[model samples]
Target: MTPGPAGTTVPAAPDAPALLRGSGLRVTDQRVAVLEVLRGAPHADADDVVRAVRERLGRVSVQAVYDVLAALGRARLVRRIEPAGSPARFELRVGDNHHHLVCRACGEVRDVDCAVGAAPCLVPGASGGPVDGFVVDEAEVIYWGTCAACAATPALLATAPDA
Candidate 1:
C-alpha cells in the first residue's frame, strides 16, 4: 500500500499484466515495474521513475524507462503533465478531464477536478464559440500557487522568486 494524503493509505494498484493486456500492449517486466512505480508515486518524473524501476529490477536502462513511459502514454494508461519550470510528471490517472494544482515554491503537484461545467470547461470568450474555427476537446488548467506546506514555511516562500 502507498501512503496517501492525511496519513491515509491507498490500496495497491490493479494487476499490471492485466492492465497491459487490456490496453492491447505486450506485458514485460520493465513495463510492470514502471506501472507499479507510478502507482506508488504519482506525478513522478522520468528520472524518478528510472531510479525506482532500477531499484526494483536491477540495471534498468534509462532509455528503457523512457520507452515504457512513452508506450504507456500512447496507450492512455498514464497521463503526462508538465508544470512550468518543472520536469514532465507521469501519473496513472487517465481518462478524466481533470486539471492540476502546482505549488510554485516547492514544485509540488496535486490533482484538481475539471473546472466548472463539463468537458472542455472554459469556452472561448463572450460569444461562447470556437476561436478561429478551432474545435476544442479539452481544457488543460494549471492553478499555480503556494501549497499549504509552502505557505506555512516562510523561508521556502522567500527563496522562490516570483515567476
Candidate 2:
C-alpha cells in the first residue's frame, strides 16, 4: 500500500516493493515499515518506531526495529539525530545540512536553516588541524531553546522565569 497523504499507513505485505525500488534498497517488510514509521513520525526514536510499526504489522521486535533503522540509515534514506539527553531520533529529511532547534524542557524538535550560510558551519581556523586529504562530510548543529508553544505557555514561563 502507498503512503496516505499524511504519510502513515497500514500497508499490505508486498507494498514494500515500490519503496525499496525507489530508494534503491532491497524491498523488505521490516525496512518498509521502518521507513513508513520514520516518514510519519519524522523524529521518532527506536522505541517509538517499534510502537508505530507494531500497530500496523503486529508483534515486531525491538531488535528488529534497531536492525532496520541501522540498515535504512546506511542507505542514506533516513537521517539520525541525537540531541543531548535524548535518545537518537530518525527522520526522512536527508541530503541537507539543516539544523535543529530543540526544546530543552519538553524535548520538542523543529527544523531551522543553517546558521553560517551553508552546509559546513565554520571555516577551518589556522589552529584547526587535520587537513590531510580528508574531506568534511555533514555537520550537525543543534540550537537549544524553548519552542514557540512552550514559550507562550504560562507553565513553561513560570519554570524558566529568565526566559
Candidate 3:
C-alpha cells in the first residue's frame, strides 16, 4: 500500500481482469478499458468513460460502456458518486470509508479520510445510529468548497456564485 495524500495508506488498485474475475464477472475488452481509464481518473462520468474507451479502442458504443459500468457497480468494483447538481461520477477507489471533497467552482473531486477516522461516521446519524429497522453500511459525505486555483482568483469566484 502507498501512503495516500490524505495520510491513509492506499492499497494498490487491482488490475482489471483480476478485479472482474474476483467479482465473478467475465473479462471483456470494454470492462478492461473502462477500468484502465478509471485507474488514473478518480471521478469520471459515463460520457467521459465512453470517450476514453473510444479513444483507446475506436468505435465503442456509449451504451456498451454504460453496461460495463453497471456490471462493475453491481460487483462493487467501482463507487459511483452523484453530487448535487452534477452528473453522476464513478471511481475505482472502493472498499474504503473515505469521503469526497468536491470543488464548487471546478467540480473537482478528491478523496478525503473518513470522518473521525476509520469510518466512525458510517452510523446512520452518528454514534450508535441507524436506530430502528435501519442498517447503515455507507455514508456519502462531501465537503464543498472552491479549489485552490479557483480560490486564488477572487474574480472567478465572484462570477461563479456557485463557488
Q: Which one wins by lDDT: 2 or 3?
A: 3
Query: Candidates sorted by TM-score, descending order?
Result: 3, 1, 2
RMSD of each: 3.1, 5.9, 1.9
- Across 1-163, the per-residue lDDT of candidate 2 in tens digits comes to 4443223332333344565787688887878888777766777888899999999898988998998888878877778999988899998777667678888767887766567766666446464444675556667889888877887787886775335
Candidate 1 residue-wise lDDT, 1-163, digit = tens: 5656544344456799999999999999999999999988889999999999999999989999999999999999999999888999999877667788888889988877787988888887778888898888888899999999999999999998663
In Å, residue 90's CA in model 3 sits off its true spot by 0.4
Provide TM-scores for the models. 0.88, 0.78, 0.90
Which lDDT values do the candidates have, in the order given?
Answer: 0.87, 0.74, 0.84
Candidate 3, residues 94-125: lDDT per residue as tens digits?
Answer: 87878888888778888887887555466664
- Record all residue pairs in model 1 with backbone atoms less than 3 Å apart, i.e. clashing: none
Model 3 RMSD, rounded to 1 decimal: 1.9
lDDT, candidate 2, residue 33? 82
The true-versus-predicted C-alpha distance at residue 61 of model 1, in Å, is: 0.7
| Residue runs of model 1 more than 4 Å from their true location after superposition | 1-13, 125-129
Tell me how far the alpha carbon of residue 56 in candidate 3 is from the true structure, in angstroms, after superposition: 0.8
